[model samples]
Target chain A: MGVFGHKTVSMTAKIRLYVDHPLGDGQTVPLDRDQAHYLFGVMRQQEGADVALFNGRDGEWLAQVTQAGKRGGELTCVRQTRPLQMPPDLWLLFAPIKKARTDFIVEKAAEMGAAKIIPVQTEYTNSERIRQDRLQAHAVEAAEQCGGTYVPEVTDLQRLDRLLADWPSTRRLMFCDEAEAGAARALGAAPRGPWAILIGPEGGFSVTERAKLHGLPFAHVVSLGPRILRADTAAVAALTVWQQALGDWDGPQSD
Target chain B: MGVFGHKTVSMTAKIRLYVDHPLGDGQTVPLDRDQAHYLFGVMRQQEGADVALFNGRDGEWLAQVTQAGKRGGELTCVRQTRPLQMPPDLWLLFAPIKKARTDFIVEKAAEMGAAKIIPVQTEYTNSERIRQDRLQAHAVEAAEQCGGTYVPEVTDLQRLDRLLADWPSTRRLMFCDEAEAGAARALGAAPRGPWAILIGPEGGFSVTERAKLHGLPFAHVVSLGPRILRADTAAVAALTVWQQALGDWDGPQSD
Candidate 1:
């Protein structure tokens, strides 16, 4: 069976669905009304059509639609297609900007292999609140679209100072300092176990916040380049830089 | 004067506007109706207020609003702020996706320092037409927001094959091959000078197109990572990788 290979499996089963239920051989998975409408009404996937399923825990499984209804549906797992390819132990900590841009950040983070996504509230951060559930949904959708077995968790908004005070010593922080813009401090030589990329808000980190971050032992201040990128662009750029330098981009899984 | 430095000049004059008129000491720049509305009606900028201005050719200039009105306004250039900082000789060739995502690709290309942006119509490209003017405006907005002196040109849609057939031999192409996903072909050793990053559409390129690109001697086929990325995410990631490896990210301007 070509089910063991990700590319081959996805080619055969075009639609990938993320479910909360477990996946295994011959396991029957139930789909909600929305999923039913999407498969039966939208995508028009009928009974006997193949669909890939993943639940963030189990490996991806090839499933065949057993019952397609207007309000609900069911699928029976054929076999494990691809093993759970966990993303690198990387987290993205970014200050939320506008509503749409914030969603873009989360979606990109998920597609780019971020293990966890946290929205931080710095002094210069404009948005005081974020819909964590909504962001998580975006992450899920991104994973579904990007052919990822794992979906990164999107945590609620947290105070930057509070999060840093109890920061894990072993987990390094890649601080994209705008003040140090155009600096040549790339992550090329940075040690890479349990890392997080911190992106500032539009106004950037306050002087006090910058001072605190600079003084932190685990903080590795770096610059994305000469230009002052908006918070959303910075998030994507930082994630890419970190991924290429220390994340899974060039890891053992990569050829 | 701190005006010559990008950081210092932007700090003093918060608003950065892109003007088509030439900028020099004691010269006056006429703002259009929309600009006047933004400066006076939206931002509430009054006469005597300082604003930073930049033309694509000229360097950034510090100007003071001399005349403020609803229909139009004028600003007198005080002095040259930051000198013209051109981006790397990079052209981003991408198959246009959705309207919003196409806009996103242009904005990010400008922010990430692409000298030119081209939307190529691949065999699988969905969008048949793109508003070059609207995309150009997005590039301008991105440059203004990112504090970039140069704005990349957004060219009209062109056929990918036609563009490739007349490809400049000196300009190497970084073809982001989704088919080669997980391949560890990092661009660390790729030659600099006049490079372009080619990103496929959501449906990806045709088999023949991929074969043709791989056969091209000037093309550097590379993979972003194991999992597939959306065209927009891939664009930003490819730009970041190329910038770090061979672009202006670590040149004389960097510390």
Candidate 2:
């Protein structure tokens, strides 16, 4: 159905929308006030306008704007356009740094195809507490902006020791170490399975933390070049390296 | 020799410096007012304080503060520390986006080891003009912060057609195409040679521009992943893929 009182018509242009509600043919998806403002007020989308919707569950779907209002709106599902293409089972674990840098890490992690985002508190971690909900919102925004159907879950702050205690033996960990500065280990050689990339804080890992990580059989320490990258950059670089090396970047179903 | 009036001392911490002046053993480097303030007022480094310095042409050097002043200062080279490690013979050509994002492209390019940075103007490019000097300064700052000895030159904005008209056949171009959303080409398979990564503006490339790029014999089109990354994130992701695939990230001398 065409918006603005026009007849129903097919559209090719993709206007991606990430909805928290379920999606299926003929299902009505409600939008919050902000989303309504964005769709109706900012983007000027009108009722009956075709919109792509993903609920991080049902794949991507073509939908029609059923009700457009200033305070709220609704989108009725039409048909599936693309399957729910989930990112690889790769997780990103890092120590929270400054507020902006931490947000940058989360945003980049979401954009770079991290399946999960975990903030770890280490001995040398500077930030004592993190606004987990805010960071998760940034991830959602990033996923929404990146045209990603799947949104990585950003978990609340967890202690490194506690998390490592239950570390999955089958999942290999790419430990980015500062001490191994010049050792540009080719991460491609590592076998791919469940994996996680662990990046430390700006001050780097403490001696005890380093020893524990090094002692882990699942940890494969890797260096991100010789230069010391800031925490945020390291997160992006590490994610890129991991994705290129063993993640879904080489797969045919990337898009 | 060490700073703060110390005798010959052993220092393990690497404090990188980027000076406009040439650097060599016994050579003197004069600091500007800002640098003087950073060293004296901020860092509180007094006379005889050891500092590492690098010019784009020269290798890194260990130097000791010779003249300490409020407005200006000087450091005399004591010994050669590390050789000038040049990044791969790779260039990054990207359309200028928002101010902060453009700055980010330059900063991450320098950190990820782009040998040259070029801003190209395309039909869909939003920014009418770019501050080349400011972007260049950001590159220099990135190099300094990342402890890189070489700083990539940031060229002024140029027409993409003109650049392609004088294209070097030996240099392979990795054109990041938005249309190839799902075809994640394996960049690792491409032969190593003079290379450049071309990232388009936020609006993406015009059809004519894509046709020109696709028609190039030297162009190797690649996809970052399934997600539609913003221009800035795409730049960093593309650079990481290139570096991990064929750039110096495989070499031992990443630092």
Candidate 3:
């Protein structure tokens, strides 16, 4: 595009951007105001600077910045560095707790390679309504920071009953139950399929909800151990356990 | 000790406290100003109410409040509830990052079952010094919050070289290196023994440091995965991975 072609320096920039626009070879990706400010004003990128772009569809592309301005910038794709590596079809379904912890859950979920993030309203869920846009932004930020090509979608908050009613029989649910503490089974032995990890809120699931979940055929009730983990900690632990056991942690590409 | 015997009602109190004093049958534990304010003023607890107490040595004990005051208070120990279940001999050695992230690391490590927490100074370590006392307090608070009977000690910051020089031959180190990012081997096949998960700083381990670590016979280098995790996220992920692999995650008591 300018001083050096993307093929010449394929592995130069560490800054990876997650864009919504389509990407391909020779395609010029336009930057929004925020991304322009970040690239030009904050990171102080100049013309011909190398940048990596991923649109969650195509593989990561090494792009050369052709124009740099405070209000607008453009980077033309040159070469694909990596294929679109999707995370395992794992879903993180958690009851929203405090605001910061909720943000943390979404961010960590993205980093740990959850395919989708869903907020469910349990009886004990503290937050009645969630800002889906804010959480989705956090997920995008996490993906960008973690160098992940895939960005998990943050679904709007739904009632726990509705979610269970519409639960896919093929998708197994790993129900994190606090009442059944210390009664957890080894996740390593769990059957591999579409899986979702359900973490409860601070006050935990109500008795009626627990009963309904216990009766659900698709729900595989498991405990996080003897310690009383907060909802956020439980989310991370559950994801880690699930990933290590059945997710992409042990996949060939990971190694 | 006052109105109710230790065996009177073991399930009455949900409040748990981490006291600095020894606890035993009929032993009166003194509460400081802060504890007094929290119990009496904040929680509105009255004399003769039951409280659970753990001092990191004895098992958790059910204690009864005997004296109520604005400045000071006392509780008489009744009986032990849960034994002092120690975490595995797994230590978390990490280069300190930002203050809040470091705190998050300590808290998560405790909640996730780390035996010892050590902050090491590496070549690319950003924080030159760490508040050992504050971090240790965080460990305690995490244990308390997670209902852990045993608390992991947060050791003072030690140079990585010095620590490696005096490394115990019995302990195996799971070195998390960014250079070997996608080339990480599975931790499942790692030999079980005294173990420590060493996470580098924000800038990652320097070349010389990585070389030394790779050359060590006791070090088993592993990667977190393809995704680039932050230092704090890496610590939690490493601990979770190790725990799910060789720690007490699959132990009989955990279930």
Using TM-score as the measure, which candidate wins? 1
User: Which residue runs does candidate 2 get wrong by more than 4 Å?
Assistant: A1-15, A178-186, A252-255, B1-15, B178-186, B252-255
Model 2 lDDT, residue B86, Cα: 87
Q: Which residue pairs show collisions in model 1?
A: A255-B184
The lDDT of each candidate is 0.84, 0.80, 0.80
Chain B TM, cand. 3: 0.91
Better of 1 and 3 by lDDT: 1
Tens digits of per-residue lDDT for model 3 on B96-172?
88788899999988988888999999877868989999999999888766677889999999999999999999999
Would you estimate the TM-scores of all the predictions? 0.93, 0.89, 0.90
CAPRI-style quality class for the chain A–B interface of candidate 1: acceptable
- DockQ order of candidates, best first? 1, 2, 3
What candidate 1 gets wrong by more than 4 Å, as runs, is A1-10, A181-186, A253-255, B1-9, B181-185, B252-255
- Single out the weakest 10-residue window by summed lDDT for candidate 1 chain B: B1-10
Report the C-alpha displacement of residue B144, candidate 1, in angstroms: 1.3
Give candidate 2's error at residue A16 in angstroms. Answer: 3.2
lDDT of 3 by residue, A175-242 (tens): 88745543454666778879998887676666788889899888887766655676777777788667
Candidate 3 clashes between residue pairs 3 or more apart in a chain or in different chains: A182-B255
Model 2: CAPRI class: acceptable
Q: How many backbone clashes does candidate 1 have?
A: 1
